[model samples]
Target: MLSDHDFLRYSRQIMLPLCGELGIKTLAKARVVVIGAGGLATVVAPYLVGAGVGYLRLCDDDIVSVSNLPRQWLYSPAHIGQQKVRVMAAQLKALQPAAQVEAIPEYADNSNLCRLMSGADLVLDCSDNMTTRQLVNAYAMDAGVALVSAAAIGLHAQAAAFQPSLCGPHGNHGCYRCLYPIDSQRAGNCQSEGVLGPMVGMAGCYQAALALRILLGDPNVPWSQLWRLDSTLGEHQLLRIQPDPSCSVCGHVSHSNASSDDSSIPNSGV
Candidate 1:
């Protein structure tokens, strides 16, 4: 059902083994929700739109500032006081007019998360703080939608994909809560710790890749595996995340049968 323009515009990716015309069409019909319009969303938005995602809902309550210019590529000096999602939506429209990008100038909190995430095929948690990430993860779990999350600060970055359906009684995937249950323990945000521009950009790129793979149903996508990168050292590490039956967010009575042995998490260099 691709128009001539769409086919021609996306022919390069359509010819790939993993992403044939079917994959491109799948992407064209996908509805995605992105949390946070800062560093990661700036990079993730353009890629999703350019690759033909049918719709994208961007949620953020922040405004552009001089400090964000180094990593957030969507804004400029003229957009200093403007809302982040508004600026991002305009730029994304310019990238691909056919894609429907909705800008919600609000944070993803208890009041509006259900409305924002309803009917989404996938959710990207690019939030800076643990509180928002935990909230988004719970929403995604209840909705049975996949969540791709990433973070960057002080030259180190991490990205992962989670599907709540894959974490029940017979499932093996882990949710965001399982990874970092205590919000007080996870601190270093980009604002206070400082981050290199390319560091967040790299994390964003990984997030985009994971999002696309999930949308395309790529069997090789590293579900629930945390990818860690050190930009300074040019090193990459992959950590397998185990499902926690005792997890406050995704745990259930039947899930208690899952292995809770946290002793042997496989680690490998990439």
Candidate 2:
């Protein structure tokens, strides 16, 4: 049952046909792990927290820098030298005091990724690099947790949801690795190609919306479909990602007695 305060706080959201009292309750019980505190996270975290997500674990090792000021709205000139996770946590707390926010001042890696995602109901990959994204994907797949991934660079942006468990028995949606094979090095990121605030913001907003839809068990949620946008051209495309049976990350791992190595995979700019 929602308390009087919660009822009032979320009155607007609860009024939506897709998100009634039950959806609000479900969101309140969901545990989410966000893998970055940069541009995408600056938008993703606050929305999830504001939506009443029960617990959000924010993982990032970077500190606020002048270069990030333009896109990372969560930080300001006063927070230039502060750790991203710490500053982001404080801001999220201020946004929604009822939401539990855990700030982990470290990058997601093999040693800690598993532990960081242990009890998460969902994982959001908002990291800017391909390495961190792949690492997050592997861990999420191993834990059978749903992952909402988004990235943007230059005038292009992309967002997708990889929910293996949520897909029915015959669902053939692919994991992140399946979509961008380990051998590919084509992803461009903000640092390399440069990006406008609105481009990154668009991807971040889509990630937040996708997360909410998944938590509410919305059947229309696009699983394994990559949403691509070229803001400069005013074009958008929804491409289905066909699972790769030969994929070493998701497919070949189980059939053969071997562990998949992701170290050689090139860095993605996103």
Candidate 3:
């Protein structure tokens, strides 16, 4: 039951054909967990809260720094040196008082992953590091929760959704590990590679869109597809991906049900 204020607050969204009163209720019933309260989370958390997601759990061990001000819009100059999860949770609560927001100011590892993902309907990977991303992917897949993963470096950004049901049918529907196998060699980090602020925002917006679609149960969304945006070249690419047959993470009979093992990496066909 939406309050009078809620109906008015979400009237425009509810009026849409795909998001009527029922869809709004669904959104209100969905629980989402977001890893890394930085770049992507800045944009994603607000939209989900504004859309009336029932519960939002944010995880991040880092504190707000001056350098993050350009892209992390949730925090202000005054919030510098404050814990990211705490600040973000406060901001989200401010936006939607009716919604529940929790802050976990600790790194999400195997130990806390299960508890973090316990009741979540969906999870968003907004972390910048590959290790954290892989952990989130594995945990979400193991928990049978849908995952929306996004990454950005420089002017390049990629966003994808992984639904457990889509993993077995096609090799294209894979997890982060399938796309980038963990080896001894490490790739570029945001600190070393440098990232454009808008690029992160662009990726974050796409992540939010996918999360909304999953929550609203919109069938038209291609959940297995990956969307790549290269603002540097002014190009956008959409690739339909299938699961990998021999993926280390998703393969093996014992872990056959693990959706995290699926992976696909987007490269510009241009």
Cα TM-score per model: 0.91, 0.91, 0.90
Model 1 lDDT per residue over 177-241, tens place? 77887644345788778899998999999999999988999999898899999878989999988
Give lDDT tens digits, candidate 2, residues 1-270: 889999999999999988999989999999999998999999999999999998999999999999999989989999999999999999999999888999999898767887888789999999888877887876676667899999999988999999855332245678788888653345577777789988889999999999999998898999989999998899999998877876655664431122445452212211
Mark the 10 consecutive residues where model 2 has the least summed lDDT.
261-270
Model 3: lDDT to the true structure:
0.80
**How would you order the candidates by lDDT, starting with the best?**
1, 2, 3
The TM-score ranking, best first, is 2, 1, 3
Clashes of each: 0, 3, 14
Report the Cα lDDT for residue 13, model 1.
Answer: 89
Between candidates 1 and 3, the one scoring higher on TM-score is: 1
Across 1-270, the per-residue lDDT of candidate 3 in tens digits comes to 778888898999989998988888999889999998999999999999999898999998999999899989999999999999999999999999988999999887766777877789999999888777877776665666789999888889999998765664343476656666673226555766888899889899999999999899988877767899978789999887656666555543223333332332111110
Q: Highest lDDT among the candidates is held by which one?
A: 1
| lDDT value, candidate 2, whole model | 0.84
